[model samples]
Target: MAKRRLIKALAALLAVLAVIGIARAGGLYLNHTASYPRGLWQKSGDYDPTHAGEHPYVLACAPGKSVRREFIERGYLPWGFDCDGVEALLKRIWAVAGDRWTVTDAGIEVNGQLVPNTQPLTEDSAGRSMPVQTGGIVPVGHVLLLSDYHPRSFDGRYFGTTPIKDLISEVTPLWTESP
Candidate 1:
């Protein structure tokens, strides 16, 4: 009887361990998808929902942190990119190249010249692209990003441009070779 009870207890313990492992793996996958910086979760910073009366260049997905590796592998751009990856990429570009870009209601202006809105870039998802504009000059440290599909996205068209300083990190593929 004692041996049987011990075996049963050990089996229960193993089952619990397995459950814990699966949960941890799921969490890690979600973080990867949410585009959190590589390795270990850390607070990026407080991003004010309001652009603070300044023109923004980047659009960040709300609930930005997760661990979904499949989403990243699919080249989904940013996790919450409802349109194209325009908002996320613009934020990254602005962070790298400052003072050279501007956001406005007439579209993106580079070096005081207007950049006509490009054709809607398509992701795997199906959607139509829309144009966005603002009436303010993109400050020296900002870039304006909008979703390629404005009607379905909550991006620069809604929140304005993002500051270059608020960018957390860029997401790139971990592997290139096909499985």
Candidate 2:
């Protein structure tokens, strides 16, 4: 009888742990990157409602193995933020489907206007050559994630376009402070 009770207890414990993991994964998102305003955001399970030129933010992970490998090798991801396998990158959408985007030595341009402070740095803070800016067309089912708030942000300027299917959630500002 005691052994049966112990087995039941273990099963109950496992079920509780599973629920906890799910809740934590679905809980509030904290904007730890300078790419967006610093604060706590509510993560909603919804498709991106952002339009072109709006620059709305979302929670995303590396869309492919190559991007994940680069992020790991180059230290592009912030320390200790691995979500499952790929680290989460919270960023504003510079361009949506059908919007044209470009990255050059001059700066990043979307729809023919250069965004200020987007000029590619020749070197990084660690004195290494900056990763090449891979400009991309905002393809259907993809978004270009970038940031105007941070000049040296590791973003679309570095990673190029991201698949929209990789978005973890749409973040809405719950509490924030000016950058």
Clashes of each: 20, 0
- Work out the TM-score per prediction: 0.31, 0.75
Per-residue alpha-carbon lDDT of candidate 2 for residues 48-156, written as tens digits (9 for 90 to 100): 4544456666788866867777677777775434455655887777788887888877789998888766777778777888766667678888888777777887777
Local distance difference test, each candidate: 0.39, 0.74
RMSD of each: 11.6, 6.3
The parts of candidate 2 lying over 4 Å away from their true place are 1-26, 79-83, 134-136
Candidate 2, residue 94: the lDDT equals: 75
lDDT of 1 at 133: 37
lDDT of 1 by residue, 1-179 (tens): 99999999999999977875674454311233222222323222333424432323332442222312333444444444332332233232221223344555555455565544422233334343333334265565544554332223333433444555645443333322231
Winning candidate number (TM-score) = 2
